[model samples]
Target: MTPGLINGHLHVSQHLLRGFVPLAVSDTSAYLFKWVFPYYETLTSREEGVAATLAGCDLLTKGVTMVADGGTVRHPGVVADALATTGIRAHLGGWSWDHASAPPGLSMDTTEALDRLSGAMDEVAGRHPRIAPLATTIGLGMSSDALLEGAKSLADRHGTFLDFHHSFDAGEVESHRSSFGDDVTPVEHLERLGILSDNVRLVHQIVSTAAELDAIQRTGASVVRCTGTRAARDLAELRGRGIPVGVGTDTVNVSNTSDVLRALHVFAAEIREPDSDIPSSGLSADDLFDMCTVGGARTLGVASFAGSLEPGKSADLVMFDALRPEWIPMIDPVNQLVLSADGGSVESVWIEGELVVDRGRVIGVDELALCQEAEEAAAGVLMRMGARARIGRRSLC
Candidate 1:
């Protein structure tokens, strides 16, 4: 038996909120402010719960036993209830975004936002033991660097974890470089702020420099590489440096299935630098498999309980269908899993000795209905904000 897949990063509510906004997938930031953040502002607690319920169901059925869900959860209790109902393990955060420069109608007072986050953490942490509390960062524009540092200290004292996006886009990279100058990158700024430690978990970290990588390694921080959303060379470099690199699908915006195995394959193949006098492949099949399970568990700081299939560990596992006819002889499960199999091959999923999915179907659920709700919710948000026309007008204007 093999251990179930550990998702190093996930955005449960963001799954439904994705295409309704224009962030990186668009050509301009106007759509983001005029449409995206306002749309998020309109998302009620109940809507987040629904999204979490549906997304959690999808993950478990795909053989993912655990996920580190990062976001500004307005109601942590509601999120925990959703996770418990779905029967999945999650590290849920009470998110905070207290930046004055943040888009209007979406910004919260810094102190008030922290108060809400703290209340949510207290309410949810005691009620849901499987759901760990984390301090998460939100907002696209520059906020008080001091707030980020303070949140890290708070999370550490609570014996919880910290998660944030780092250097995800070229524009963000440039913004950091221009603001901070040659003295440091945003990550270096984070390091100075005292958040660079084993408890810190970063999503993306795509455009960071080699020196910054060394700093993260020195501090024992972990990085969750969304291979489905990044260039391959970035993953390879991080892997070579002994950084705890795990695999994630990012969002349905980037990948429809959110399958780590497929993400690994896409990255492994994409990062190839044109074989040069090299006798061995840049990435091995086993390496990719380890990234999905062992690496992911380590990145999330849950290796002791979740990484591998061993006695005394929780019974979390996934069974894939037999090798395809093309792979007539099952040479290596690792190879087949990384290079050949998709979500279709997943036959069953077990989490904490409970069966959540069997025979390639989510137990006691209607996927079509879920899809309809997600689509309708997304369309409603877009329509309310006039996002389609707004995007076009912004381009024309």
Candidate 2:
């Protein structure tokens, strides 16, 4: 049997783009404004539901009982309902993008954005307690950044955590350097905004320097490593510092569902890059396992509720069929899981002592039907935007 897995970070709506586009968009600026927002603007609540439900159902099959849906579209409540229907536990966040000079198609009044997010949270919270909806602010992760302060205030008022993408890669670092003069990194910016608190759950953070890492450690803030998309060294350094870090699949851009096993294995392999002479002996398979299960729960501040299979904790457990050819030796179950297990191995999944998925199938979902709906939605939206043919075409040459 597999331990209950907590998907520390994910954006459910991104599931529709899984395997449909390139892994990473080359033209991030044009893609975000021209294609992403324009296409997303066409997304209906039902469409978002279909995407979240499909992704959540897949997580059930992968032994992932919990997920932090980092941010949702306009009607986040609809996404929450989809998760409830799929029998997956989720922390649904209502995202807010408020700035006068924000990117095109993303500008919204600060007060209006907050109001909408609050309304969405109240609506989702009233529907299901498992769907812990919170108002979130998205920023480039710089200290004292406008978005960071807003996230802190909103989180305090709602008793919820603020999720932000922090120091994703070298490109973001350069942007921060350009926006704020030298001698300041993005993490320091978050510190200045009073956002590096226990209530903050920063995602990615691949580019944080040693000093910033120490700063985050001092704040007692948790780091969520999207190992599926991040370089392995990024996660290993945090682990070495004895910092609290969790693993995530990080949207369909990396993979469809937030399967912790995939993330852990990738992280382990990545830590052994050629340039870095770091010995991989100390980081065992179990260490990676811990990062996905208990480690994830700790990052999300839900350890008391459902990290391990202790008697009193909520009985969120996953059982994988051990009869597969991948289990040839089967000497160590955890090791076998990381090396061989995929979403298909999940045989049963339980959440809060309830049988949410049994026999590798979500309790109340039709996989084929959901796929068809999602396909139709994607086509409809793409066509409506008058840019259907340019979906994944790039003029890199």
Best by TM-score: 2
Residue 381 shift from truth in candidate 2, angstroms: 2.0
Alpha-carbon error at 305 in model 1, in Å? 1.0
Tell how far residue 171 is off in model 2, in angstroms: 2.3
lDDT per residue (tens digit) for residues 158-230 in model 2: 6777787776678878788678776677778677767787778878777778788888888878888885344
Off by over 4 Å in 2: 99-105, 141-144, 228-230, 273-281, 387-397
Model 2, C-alpha of 131: deviation from truth (Å):
1.0
Positional deviation of residue 76's Cα in model 1 after best superposition, in angstroms: 2.7
Candidate with top lDDT is 2
Clashes (candidate 2): 6
For model 1, give the 10-residue run with minimal summed lDDT: 388-397
Local error of candidate 1 at 385, Å? 3.1
Q: List the residue pairs that clash in candidate 2.
A: 142-189, 142-190, 143-189, 143-190, 144-189, 144-193
Off by over 4 Å in 1: 18-35, 139-141, 228-230, 273-281, 323-329, 364-379, 387-397
Give one digit per residue, the lDDT tens place, for model 1 in 373-392.
76666656566665553332
